[model samples]
Target: MTTNQRRAARFNKAFGNRLAGPLLSRMPGFGAVLHKGRRSGRVYRTPVKIFRTAGGFTMSLPYGPKSDWVRNVQAAGGCQLVSLGRRFDLVEPRVYHDREQRVIPRPLRPLLARFKAFDFIELRLAPAGAGRAER
Candidate 1:
């Protein structure tokens, strides 16, 4: 990440996120990624723009695929997604770069592209009674 990017990330971590997380977590087309720290074993919830795909969901890695939360999800092999105010367990995370940005809805493609976001992660919904639980 460049200096500006790193500073922006730090700013979000320290301030912006605290204000946006609660609202974003409940909004349609937006969600929260609930992942655990790979080493610290601490839990985190990050606001994200998520889109549904057949049998799964896709999230753009604007922070880049190497972001701590993304790494945590990959290392753990799964994570929980809070979408539309409901919690869903997800597994089989697949992170890859796609300039076509095909899995997500078309309208969002341009927006992500503008951010230079070509990397994304897709995860299948955990089977009912396998891991998913909603409230």
Candidate 2:
């Protein structure tokens, strides 16, 4: 992360996200990941571009793998996702860096590339009725 990129990121987090989060949460191919902070335990809902795959879902790490939301999800080993008015339990977070962005859908690759989102996170859906009896 260069100095300028860091500054821009901070600016986006402070202002841009406030406006974007709500819109993204409701958009197609986008979703909100709900996870708890590792240290603070406070929950966070982060907007992300998520695509369903054969096994699970893949998300473009636009802010990179070190983003707070990513770290929290990784630490917790799972997170809940809400998209298109549906809910999902995602587990086994795997962050990978790929220049080709092969895991991303064809039409959306260009947009993610423009954002320098080379890193991606993949998660598999929890088995059906898994832990249903727990709660």
Candidate 3:
């Protein structure tokens, strides 16, 4: 991460996480990635800009991979996400640098581009129509 990225991360943790995180997490198109702490086992909800993809969903990592939520999800191999008024069990975690951010909604692309958040968290959502137990 560059100096700017580091600064932004700090600011987000200090303010954004506490203030905007909860509200955004509940809204449509924006939601929370829920993960457990690597050691403490405490659950955490992180606000993220999420977009639906062909098979699943992609999240913009504005704070890059070093963010706590990103690390937690990666370490655990899977996590739950609440978005679009539904709960999804997301698995097969992968990280990538989506330079063009093609997965993001067109209207939001420019805003995300300004933050240079090319890092993305990709996960495969459980098959639709699966029974509650399957999900």
Name the best candidate (by TM-score): 1
Residue runs of model 3 more than 4 Å from their true location after superposition: 127-135
lDDT at residue 125 of model 1 (Cα atoms): 95
RMSD of each: 1.4, 2.9, 2.8
Clashing pairs in 1: none
Model 1 agreement with the true structure over 1-135: per-residue lDDT tens digits: 667767877888788778998899889988998999999999998888888888778898887888888899999999999988789899999999999988867887888888788889999999987877588
**Consecutive 10-residue window with the lowest summed lDDT within model 3:** 126-135
Query: What would the TM-scores of all predictions be?
Result: 0.92, 0.87, 0.84
**Clashes by residue pair, model 3:** none
Candidate with more favorable, higher TM-score: 1 or 2: 1
Candidate 2 Cα misplacement greater than 4 A, ranges: 131-135
Stretches of candidate 1 above 4 Å error? Answer: none
Q: lDDT winner among the candidates? A: 1
- Each model's C-alpha lDDT? 0.87, 0.83, 0.82
Of 1 and 3, the candidate ahead on TM-score is 1
